[model samples]
Target: MNAFEINGLSKVYENGNRALNDVSLTVPKGSFYALLGPNGAGKSTMINILADTVRPSSGTVSLLGHDLFNERNWCKRRMGVVPQEIAFDPFFTPREVLRFTSGLFGCKPDEAWLDELLDRLELTVHAGKKARQLSGGMRRRLLVAQALVHRPELVILDEPTAGVDVELRRKLWDFMRELNDAGTTILLTTHYLDEAEELCDHVAIIDHGALLTAQPMRALMRDIASSYLWLNYGQAVTLTDADHDALAGLEPRSSDEGVCLKLGRSENGDSTFHQTYQAAVARFGPPLDAGVRSEDLEDVFLRLTRRAGGDDAAAECKS
Candidate 1:
């Protein structure tokens, strides 16, 4: 069964702003899924709808095979959401917070699991400290612990590592990986594309309140055949007229290493890298080193969003 099945999910604000538009997506069970978008791209709206904090203008959502609207309590109990905003009772200690959260979920406090969570999140030393006394990173850790206190089946983390230090972020991801390995479904949204690229197996990108694409991470990466090659001659190399002619079609720009050549796959099914490298080597007389920078999530995101936006604009003009 899928972790979440969202069908034609659309959200419109009272001000007539459409947050999400006809977005349909399925998050596979036990998979690390990433829901990515730019600022005001309806990511937060969709997430809040899943958490039941925001009501959608239209569309249906299912959580773990159950109709979310019909079985709100049942679904809520099985889902743990870490919202972007951090809010807590200042007087409550981390221990109290987790205990209270467990009670809210109709679960008796699991002391052993609680201890393990605190230790794993590095919150044991501050377990007794009031929420107001903890630093930003520590408070974020507390939020994560609270979310996992009842060991929910589906976890939605929205920018869980935002404002967290590097060391703490590493620890947090490690803990999350452990949870995922133990058969928990995780849905993550973050501005950090590298994190999504590295941690998530499946990715969905939305822009202008529309779902652009949703596919396996590997498949998405493989579809992007464009790449840039960086060559290093160990020193500056002047581009002669011959070198310019050979690299005419390729977008060559000077780099610290030597130069960078933008390459796109040709229709003849020739390896662009081989052709470009040969042309550079023929003139530059063999570089000290060479590296190919393949298209990553960031490149894909920018290209899709810009292209989609242009298409929408053109459609409006024609209409």
Candidate 2:
């Protein structure tokens, strides 16, 4: 089942700005998906379209089997969103906020259910605090809690952990994971690639209002196929002629941590970490120490977005 099905979604503001261009995506039900893009990559525009807060130029959007344009009310009722900015009134208490939000969907306050949400999000202690009075982290948690007041099937989080403490961020993601495990779909967008890598099951990269790639995290990362081999020669020594040639093009960096060589992942690369360490030994010979670090989500993100943006910029500049 798809929580969201969008095709050919495009939005062009009257100011001659194209917020989205031919964007298409499908978010699976009960999956934690990450929608990543650079600043002004049309993420906010896309989110607004999904939430029905903004209209599209040409496209179709469906939410949990409900046509967003035709069955708008049903679609809106089945999804929740935690926006990047704080959207509540400062004077309102957490309890009051949830009460008002749920009421929007014609849901009367159920004390037990409300309490459960507050507790699950660890907002019980600050339930009575005004939004202005709560700490940033507390306010962020309250934002998420209110989004769940109506028990929506899909939850969209835009930078949910921004400015949050590490411990609190971990707790928040843990709750999000639990919600996903229990069948709620989670769609996240954030500048933090590490966060997406840590929590998302699938990832979609969009740039210049266009979709770059959408695939399971592991599958997408497999394309990188690169790692770093850190080596220690025991004592400071110059590279032998053979050593220089063998390590050529590795962009090796020297530091106290030893010589770090950028390694291109071979098609026949080792299948396991232990095997990788052994392979490093075979390539670099014995050293006082050696380590391997693979390319992470950040690496992939930078490469794809930069390439896409560069190409788009050149074309736009030509005219």
Candidate 3:
């Protein structure tokens, strides 16, 4: 059975902004799913609806077979959410904060579990420090721990690693993987496409309050089928319109020192594009240095968003 399911979920704010438009998706039990999109793509709105922080304008949400809107307590007990914003009482220590949060959920303090959480999150030594005294990264870690204090079955992390240091980010990824491996369902909304590519098993990309696509990470990446060729040279090279037209399947654009060729979906791997790019470099000799590289999730994201037009809100959500 799916851990969480949303059907025809739509949310329109009081200001007449359609935050989410008929967004529907399901997350299987114990699966790691990433909801990716630019700002104003309705990521946070969807999450808020799931967390019961906001009510949807239309549609339903079912978590573990229970209707979320109606069965608020039951759903709240089973799901935990780490929001994008870091919010906590500045005066409380990490342990004190978590203890208070757990009590609010009617959960008794589990010192052992709490200690283990802090240890894993690298906040053990800082547990005694006030929330205001912790560094930005430490505060982020504390937010994650606070969500897990009740040991909920499903956890939603909204930009959990944003503004965090590299080491802390890596540690959080590892912790999340461990949770998923232990049968906890994880739903992540992140601006970092690379993080989504590395951690999520399934992905759903949204744009302008609409669902663009939902599939396994591998399948989504495969469907894009695009690559980038970066050309570097000792001296600047000028190309005529005819020269650009010669690389028909490739979209060529000028860079600071050299040109960049963006290979289309139908184009094959480095072999064909590499040969053509090399030929172009050879023809333009003296100054051109060429390199062909496969595209990653970021490229796929850009292409998808661009295809949807430059929706500024969606773009802002991405960061």
Candidate 4:
């Protein structure tokens, strides 16, 4: 069974702002999936809906084959959510917070598991410190530990590494990879496209509350057989009027190392890479070095979002 099945899901806030359109998506069981979007793409709204914090205007959702509305408690029992915001009781220590959260979920305190979590999250040294005393990164880690205290089958991470250091980020992802390898399904949302590209096999991009593209990472990549041809001359090449006229339609980006031209098919299904490259090479002389840089997730994201006219406003009135 799929981890989640959402059909025609939509959310409209009280301020007459529509946060989600008729969005339909399915996340396969045991797969690491990414829900990607711009600032106001309704990703947060969708996460809140799944966590039962926000009510959808209209939709049907199933978690692990159980109706989210009819079997709400059942679904919640099997799922864990790490929110973007860091919030917890100021007086409670890390250990106390985990224990309390576990109890609320009807789970007996598992000291061994708790210790393991603290160690894995690098919070063992600060286990006795109050929540308010911890740094931003530590608190973020605590949030993750709290979400997993009960060892739910499905884990949803919304910007879990927002404020963490690079070393800690790598360490956290290693721990998460271990958990995913042990059969825990992960759903991640982050502004870090590289993170999503590296970790997730399946991806879905939303823009302005509308579903833009949802497909396997490999399949999505296969549709774009394009690359940037980087030509590095020994010296910088100055662009003249003659050069500009010759390089028309190539969209050349100049750097200290000669010029880089975008080589791809046009919207009308015409490939100009070979034609453009030949003409530009004849004009600018042979380069000292040359290579091709393949398009990545960031390229795909910008292209799709730009096509949809997405803006920088926060979605659902939440950042």
Candidate 5:
């Protein structure tokens, strides 16, 4: 059964700006789903709607088989949300903050579980420190802990590792993996493509409030099995008509450095491409230094979203 299902979902601002358009997707139970898009791409809007923080202008949201709008309280009880903004009372310590959150959720406070959460998040030492006393990273960790305190079946993390270091980010990834392994579903939205590529089972890309594509991560990569080859030359080498014809199947484009060839699956097999590429380099002589690499999720993301249009693509690329 699907953990969450959004059908023809949409949202429009009071000023008449449409933030989300006819977006529909399903997330499987216990899966780590990553929602990728540019700033103002409606990622947060979708998340906020799911968290019951913002009501959708139209369409339906069903979570764990319960209609979100109809069974509002039940949906709220089953979902945990860690929003991008970390808000807290400056005077409240982590312990007090978590205790208050639990109270709001009507969950009995468990000191042992709270301690374990703090330890895992590496915030145990800061447990007694007020929110204002903690660093930015520490506060982010505290927000995650706050979301998990009630032990909801599904957790939504919006830019959870935005300003975190590599080590802590990896630690958090492992922790999230552990939670999903134990049957907790995770829905993540982040600008970090590497994290999404490494951790997500499913990925959905949206732009201009429209759903561009939603597929299993493996399937998406396989569907676009094209490697973007970057080549550098000590001296600029002008392309001959025959040279362009030789690699006709692959679309080759020139940049300031040298050239880039986008090799699709039908163009040449991996082994053949390597052999042909090396031969071309040898024939081109001394100046050319060629490197062939696979196209990662980031590359596919850029290509797909750029085709969708708007200035948001440029902003997302910069991010």
Candidate 6:
């Protein structure tokens, strides 16, 4: 069964900003899903609606076979959320916070499970410290611990690493990966596209409150026909107006090693690429070598979301 099945979900604010516009999407069970969009793209609105914090204007939402609203308790019990902002009480210690959250969720306090979470999340050392006294990364981990205290089947993380340091981010990723591998469904929203690409099995791109495409990570990369060719030049190259026009969309930029040019054979053929390379060599002398790489998720994301400000498309999920 799908972890989340949202159909024609729409949300309009009091000021009439339609945050979600008849959006329909399904998140597969036991997958790490990335819900991506720009600011005000209805990502937060959708997550809030799932968390039952924000009411949608119209549509249906089902989580883990429980129709949202009608079986509120069941659905709520099956989902956990790490919000973009810190929502913990300043006075409560990490242990107290977890106890309170589990109680609020109507779950019996499992001391063993709580202790395990504290140790794994690296909050054991600061478990007794007041939340406000902890470091930023520790506090973030505390939020994660709080979310998992009740052992929800679905966890939604929104920018969980926003202010976290590099080491903590890696640690959190490892923890999340382990949880996902253990059959937990995770939905993550973050501006860090690289992280999403590295960790998520599936991706949904949305903009202007509409879902542009949802598919397996590899399929999205395949949809884009472009690649990059990095030219390692021994010296600098000068470009005339004509040379620039011949290499139009490539937007060749210089790097420490050399220059990088965008290449797409389907749009313009191999002849264009060779001509550009020759022009660079003639102008700057011989190039050390060239490296080629396929386009990545960030490229696909920018194209879809930017175009979705007024247009859209549908892509099948390759589950």
Candidate 2 structure quality by residue, lDDT tens digits, 70-153 = 997787788888888877789998899888988997789888989988887788888888889988878888888888888899
Residue-level lDDT of model 6, residues 117-198, one tens digit each, is 9988888989899999998878888889988989889999988998888887888899899999999999999999999999
The pairs that clash in candidate 3 are 38-314, 38-317, 38-318, 39-313, 39-314, 39-316, 39-317, 39-318
Worst 10 residues of 5 by lDDT: 310-319
TM-score of 3: 0.85
Models ranked on TM-score: 5, 1, 4, 3, 2, 6
On lDDT, the stronger of 1 and 5 is 1
The residue-by-residue lDDT of candidate 5 on 146-212, one tens digit each, is 9998899999999999788889889999999999999999999999999899999999999999999
Better of 5 and 6 by lDDT: 5
Over 4 Å off, model 5: 229-233, 255-258, 266-271, 278-290, 307-319
Weakest 10 consecutive residues of candidate 1 by summed lDDT: 310-319
Best by TM-score: 5
Candidate no. 5 TM-score: 0.89
List RMSD in Å for every model shown: 6.2, 6.5, 4.5, 5.9, 3.9, 6.1
Question: What TM-score does each of the candidates earn?
Answer: 0.87, 0.83, 0.85, 0.86, 0.89, 0.83
Better of 2 and 3 by TM-score: 3
Worst 10 residues of 4 by lDDT: 310-319
Better of 2 and 5 by TM-score: 5
After aligning candidate 2 to the native by TM-score, how far in Å is the CA of 34 from where it should be?
A: 0.6
Report the error of model 1 at residue 25, Å: 0.6
Clashing pairs in 6: none
Each model's backbone clash number: 0, 0, 8, 0, 0, 0
Off by over 4 Å in 6: 232-286, 307-319
Q: Would you list the C-alpha lDDT of every candidate in the order shown?
A: 0.86, 0.79, 0.82, 0.86, 0.83, 0.82
Model 6: residue 70 alpha-carbon error in angstroms: 1.5
Candidate 5, 83: how far from true, in Å? 0.3
